[model samples]
Each structure stands twice: as C-alpha cells, then as structure tokens.
Target: MTSPRMIQIASGKGGVGKTWLSVTLAEALAAMHRDVLLFDGDLGLANVDVHLGLVPTLDLGSVIAGRARIEEAITTYEIPSVSGAAGGVKFDVLAGKSGSGVLSALTRTEIAGIARALSRLSERYAHVVIDLAAGLDQSVMALCTPDSTTLVVVTDEPTSLTDAYAFIKLLTLQDAEADIRVIVNFANDREHAWRTHAALTNACKTFLGIAPPLAGFVPRDNLVRDAIRRQTPILFRHPQAKASEAVRKLARDLLVPLPKSTPGPVLRRGA
Candidate 1:
C-alpha cells in the first residue's frame, strides 16, 4: 500500500493557533473524502482532546504504558450534521493524555518507538496530520522526519518570529533539505500575512541559505475563538466563517499533486 502523506504542524511558541489549524486542516481534508488521522504529537502537554472536548478512555499514554496497543488509542470523531443535511465529515484522532506528564518523562528509546508506530500507522490512511508540541525540545524534534512536510506556524509577534527562526534553523542543521513550509496565523489580511512570511523567509534565506515557501495563511476571526470555547471545529460550527474559508482554501492548496517520494525512516534520537 502507498504510504500516507505525513503533514506535521509545528510552531516555535505556543498560542499561535497551531492546534486549531491542525484540527481544522484535518477536518477539511476529511470533508474532501480523504482518510485522515489527527495525531496529537504533543506528548508532554497534549490538548488536542481538550480542543475537541473528547474524553477518551485510552490515549497515547496508554500505548506508552503498554496498557493498550497504538491502534487502541485512536478515537473517531464525527461532526453532526445540521438540519438533517448530509452526514458531516468523519476522521480519526489519536488523543494524548493532558495534565499527566508520564508520556513526557519517557526515554529517548520509548519516544522513537512511538515515532515508528506512527509511521506504521500511516499505511492505513491517506494523510496523517501530527500536531507537534510547541518549542524545539528533543522529543519534539525527534518526531520530525525529513520525508514529511513540516508546516511551521507563526504570527506577527517578534517573539514568534524569533522562535520560528530558531526552530527552522535547527531543522536545517539536522537536514538542510527538509521539506519545511510556513503558515501565517491570525493575520490581519493577505498582505499582512505575506509580510509576516517575508520576514521569516528573508531571515532564513540570509542566514540558512533556504527560504521555506508559504503554504497559506489564516486571517483573524472571532468565530475561531467561539469554536474553541465550545470545543468544536470552526468548519463545523461556522462553515461560512472567514477563518473556515481560509482553512478550506489552504486544504485545497495542499491537495494539489506533488512529486511522489519514498518516506525516510523515522528519526531516532535520545530524549
């Protein structure tokens, strides 16, 4: 079977809407009839379940503790249709335990094991969208493979840009040819988003001799906040919202054909 395309969503700092993008992007892909799995890769402080308001009995923690198989940790989330419209999109989610730091305390070998498991799990789906933990920690970097496309989410804040540069720099050091892309979140408009992307791209070009192209951008929208508060995806709660529209456009862009390549082996490093 053809391996699923792995899309890793990462950010330099937290609160840049990385998790939200991950959820909505997966939903958008599912809406397009592609099989998708939203893997919560934030082992230390996972909130993907919280964002979706899911209370799974088994989670990644269960897999790490040997209480459950990796497959057993997956939970299917289906959006409810409104007014008896066609059934809403359905996708699978591999939730992570929130609050408990047990998964975070795992050794490097254990982390690599989970990474390998994820790579194997990709065979069953068309796409695997991993929402990585914020920052450039060892565990976070270990999950990043050169074969996958990494979407580094950034905002206009100075700190956000600096931290993004740091994360990109590390990736470049690890693999100069890594497929890294940028996504501008909470931008005022397209022009503003491009400007933000330019700032980061220019720095990368000058310092690292590489400029990761912009995958897309999401404009600031009030409905996004409402969806998060309600523990629902904006695409379902307000499909016509500005942010939802932007995300759908981004998802469409991603569907375009690209050169196929074999996935590299999972990165194995000590934590």
Candidate 2:
C-alpha cells in the first residue's frame, strides 16, 4: 500500500479554526472509510483533546520521553450514530501533552526522531492529519517536508492576513516547492473568501513569487461554536450547518483520487 499523505494544518494566528479544520477533515475522511491518523502537532500547548472533550492518557510527550510508543498513546474517536448502531466511523488520534511548555525546548534531534517515527507510523494509514502550532516558528517548520501538504488557515483580520503571509514566506524559504494551500475561515460569503484569497495570492506572487491555490472557505457559522462548546464535531452534530457543509465539500475537494494500480493518500494545507 502507498504511504499515508501527511497534511499539516497550520495558521498564521491562533483562533482561526486551524485545529477545528484538522480534526473535522480527519472525521470526514474516516466517515468515507479512509483510515486516518489525526496527530496533535502543537507541542507547547495541545488543544485537540480539549476541543474534542477527550482526556488522553498519553500524548506526543510520552513518545518523545520514551515512556510510550507512538501507537500506545493513540486515542480512538468514534462518530456516534443517531440510532446507536454497531457500526460507525472511527479514527485514531495522537494527542499532545497539555501545558507542556517543555516540549518547545526539545532539541532538533528529538524532534527529528519524532518526525521519523511519525513518518513510519503513517504508512499504516491513508491520511495523517497534523494540527501544527500557530505561527511560522521552528515547531511548525519541523513537520514540513517535500512530501507534506501545508494548509494555511486565515481570516479577514489584518493581523491574521499578515501572519499568514509570513508563514507562507517562511515555507518558501525552507522549501520553495512546498505544496501550500489556503482556507479562508470566517468569511462572510464566497465573494469575501475569494477576495481574501486573491489579496494574499497577489501579494505572494509580487513579493515571494509563490502562489498557493485557494483550496476553499468556511463561512461564518454559530454551529461551529456550539459544537466546540459541546466538544463534538460540527460535522457530526450539525451536518446540515453551513460551516459543516462547507467543510465536507472542502474535504471532498482535497481528497485526490488514486489510480487503481498505485493508490495514494490525500493531504491538504492552508495559507
């Protein structure tokens, strides 16, 4: 089987729905019967567990500290059915240590060891969704590789746009051929989303000489907040919500079809 496609979901700023998109995309893929691994890549302060309302017994810290194997710490997330059926979509989640500021102090070798381990583990799944830390920092860049897809999430806020630009610029510096994609969150409508994407792309084309495609947009929706409050995925709790529909569509658009002779995984990024 082909190795899983690694997707790094990142944002220029926090609170732009980076983790939200990452976990939901993983769920969407799992709902489609794709084996996926949703890794919480934010080492400093892991929030995937918090958002999902899961209390992970272990996290990346366990793997890095040699206390647990990568597979040992994985938590399972099952999509509940309305009728409480036996079969439902399920996926694996590797959470991050909550309040582990020391993770940020990890040496390069330690980080590389984790990356290699994750790379090896990814071969077992079709998609590996990584929720990277916010900003264009070393923690974010460490997960990036020639084969990885970087999804940069942005908003209409001025700081969000500027930070998104900086993140993309840093990726270019690291790997000019990096596959960067954009997802405009909190957009008022399709027009606003396209406008935001165009502005960012035009700026990159003028200065950095790299223009990543606008993968899609997630319109503003209160259901997203409600789902977060309940620690449930909007996709599962409110599939008909505007935000949920948008994410489902985005997930489908990003999932590239593989040839029967050589099937490959689907990965996505924003920026």
Candidate 3:
C-alpha cells in the first residue's frame, strides 16, 4: 500500500461538535488555499455536507450501490475567502452514505476498494479529513483505523470523558499504531482542556497500556454556535476568534505531516 495523506476525525460520543470541528478544519484548510477534501465516513448519520448546506449530489450511497464510483462523487466547493493558508489551498469533498441502514461490515475486498478510492483522493488533495461516525462500529474502525491519523474529539463533561475512555479502550483492543490525536472541545480554558485530557491519558496508560496524546482544544465560544446558526463557519464569522485560532493550528499540523503509503486502488464490485 502506497501512503497518502489521510486524516480521520472521530469522537467517543455524539454532540461533541465533531462535525463542526471537521468542517471547520476543512474550511480553514480551503481558506489557506490548500487542496483539501473532507470525506463523511459517518454513513449512519451523514451531516458533513448538510452542515455546508450542500445537497447530496454524490454520496457514498451511490458508491456502495454501484451507481457511482467514489472518486466520481467528490464535489468541489469554493471557499469564500477570509484567507487561511499562506501557501495556497483549494479543495472538494465526498459525502458518506446517510441512512438508518446497517453497513454490512466490509469484507477485506470492500475495505481495499474504499482504501484505494481514498488514496486517489489523497494524491490530489494536500489534506483529506474524514468525519467518522461516533462510537464503536465496524464502520468506524475501518474508516478511522490505524492506517491514518485518527483524531478523537472530546469535551469536559462526565459523559464525554466516559466515552473518550471507552474509545481509547476500544482502540487499544483493536490497534494502537494510529496517530491518535485527542482534541478537547468546548474547553472553558486551556487548563480545563488539559485536565480532561489528563484524565483520558491516565486511563489509557493505566488501563489500556497505550500512549495517546492530546492534539489541541478549541475554547468554548459563542462564535461556534453563532456561525452554525448563520450557516457560516466560525473561522469565517470570527477569523480572530479562539476557536478559529485553534482550528488553524490543527490545519497546519495536518497539512505537512509525514505521508503514509498510498492506499491501494479501489476495486469495483466484482462478480
């Protein structure tokens, strides 16, 4: 497998602003003029495109059903410039299949196909961020599993902490080689965020026998809520806001990371 730039955004619980973070990162990258693509691998509750107010022109549904190839389904969105990356970036994305429908766990063949398609996209985009579904599922594991940089977003809440621990435990059971980036959202302050992160790390180290580091945290700000309500990104709404700054840092870290061997070519459903 040839390596390509692969990024996975995930969380232990829903409603932790995971989608918001994913879209924000992608939007920020686009603003910076970096070739970017955000894939919605959260098939069960696809909202990445919805958050952007985009219709499901092409979705993983079509790709899975043989109606379309995954690459052919990618949609290019023009980022309204507030300006982000100085190096230059532009990008597009492919939305995942959204349904109550259960995704039959992909066989090795299906996994290979999905990986191949993603690798091709990576070759084109400087960064590809995938928004994975919340919690433990075969889909989540396959979409966010070790081969890519897996970013798990959390918050300072009992529920969030519990789920974050759960996720680390699950990841440890399955695989530990992933570049696990833990982000604490809605942080009251840096200290608050670090405390939450410390708890998670302690659990991982004490119980899971693994080391997953805190990537960063987005300060709790009204800008995030307001932007979503305004149907604009917070990074756009308040370019200088704390949340925007946090996202910028994350985008930079992701943009130039050591590349992974490109994923294999996607295979069409075989007879």
Candidate 4:
C-alpha cells in the first residue's frame, strides 16, 4: 500500500511569505529526485502561478466548473535540485479558483472524492505540498483533512504573532491530534525567529496543553521583494539570497530521513 501525500503551508497573518516558502520547498524536494505537487489551497488569494511567473492554463475553478479536468488544470514547472550543480524534475501545480465557483465545486462528497484522488496521485509522486488559506474555512478543511505535515508560517510583528496564536487555536479545535510544524518567516535573525516560534509553541502548550514543534525559520531578505517585482520566485531569480538558502536547508531537513517512519496511527474516514 502507498501513503498519502499532504503538507499544508499557512500563516496566522498575511504577507509573511507562507506561499513563497511553500513553493520553494516543493521545488527543493523535487530537486532531491522526489516527485512533488504544489496545490494552491487558498481560494481568497490564489497566486502560486504569480510566484512562478506562469499564468496557469487552467485552475481548480475551471475543473470544478466542468470546464477542465483535474489533469488538464495541472501545470508543470522545473525546480532546481538540492545539489545546485544538478537540475531537478518537474512539479504539477494545482492552482485554486478565484471566483464564486470555488464553493460550488467542493461539496462534502467532492471533498471525499478529492481526498481519494490525492492519494492515488501521492502513490506516484514523492511529496505533495498544499498552500492553505490564512484561516479556517470550507476549502481549508477539505484540503487539510488529509494533511500529514503542517507548516504554520509567521513573522515577528504583533499582528502576525496574534494571528499565529489564533490559527493554532482553531487547529486545536479542528485537528487536535494533528502534527503542527511552525515556521517563522521574515525574521531579523535567528533570535527574532526563535521568539516568534517560542511564543506560538508556548501558547499551544498553555492553551492546548501541547508544545508544537518548530519546523524552522526563513530570514528577511530584500531580494524576495525584488524577485516578486520581477514576477519570479526568489529560488529561481536569486538562488543565493538568505531566504533561498534557508528554504534549501529546510528542504533537506524535511526530506532527509529522521529516526524512522513509524506509521502514524490511522483514522478511518466515514462516508
């Protein structure tokens, strides 16, 4: 039997480079010879294509609207390998819909279908990275219902901090048993990043009574802004940037083997 691939990238607040990190991480894993799929689960502000600077030929909106097939909506892009000296394989990006059609496509039944479909895809691919919305919602639940790894991105700013705490609060209520991985983005340095991670982890322990694991941090680099202005991802535009370097290290950290893959207990899905 094959395992399902689901990892969600999100933040408590907006503009903390959640989407950016998700895209780059997916690319990094692909470089390591892992098949990956980056799904833009954010309906309110779907822009994975913008980060890659490629206008998706089709999006989930079209697929749900019967205008496109799941396969037809997938766009393939090249991501550099971790070796830096070698090239990486391609990743299929599933962009989300922008209009009212987003709600119409994912009924309770459709979500179930999506879960099954993603598993089949995961069997063939190595990693499937999902970019979820900022907060809890219909789409977020549907996509995250299958998540095995979760990365919560945040910044040192007050709003981001408060939002990160609120996000974990909602997760506790929804998926209390889920593994929460925290990522602090746009930090001044390691110290600032640790503070943000510590704050969130401490809150999870205090409120939810569980200490969340710190995934890692991404440094604040002006090159990210410049890359965005150029309509390209920093990983591709400025591979040497601090943010890029951080993500590459993170890619190996996540992809590299840990103690072992003890099967996390299974939760049977009901019809």
TM-score of each: 0.92, 0.90, 0.83, 0.84
Task: Report residue 40 deviation for candidate 4 (angstroms).
Answer: 0.7
State how far residue 255 of model 4 sits from its true place (Å).
Answer: 1.3
lDDT of 3 by residue, 1-271 (tens): 2323677888879999999998998888777776778888776778777677677676777788789877789887655544432223346878876554544455646755686778766877767888888987766766654567778899878888788788767776677565676888998987788788888878777887765766678898888888777656677668889999989977765555343442122111220
lDDT of 3 at 194: 77
Worst 10 residues of 3 by lDDT: 262-271
Clashing pairs for predicted structure model 1, backbone only: none
Per-residue C-alpha lDDT of model 4 across residues 1-271, encoded as one tens digit per residue: 1333567787767788888888888876776677889988776677788777677778877776789777788888865433443244678898876444444346756765765666666666778898887765555666666347777888778788778787777776778766677788878887777777788767777877876666677888899888777655567668889988888877776754444333222212220
TM-score between candidate 2 and the true structure: 0.90
Ordering by TM-score: 1, 2, 4, 3
lDDT of 2 by residue, 109-221 (tens): 77777888889999899889999999766777787766787788999888888899999998889887677889999999888898888888888999998677787899999
For candidate 1, lDDT tens digit of each residue in 105-175?
77767788888999999989989999999998888888887678888999999999999999999988988
Sorting all predicted structures by lDDT, with the top scorer first, yields: 1, 2, 3, 4
Q: What global local distance difference test value does model 1 have?
A: 0.86
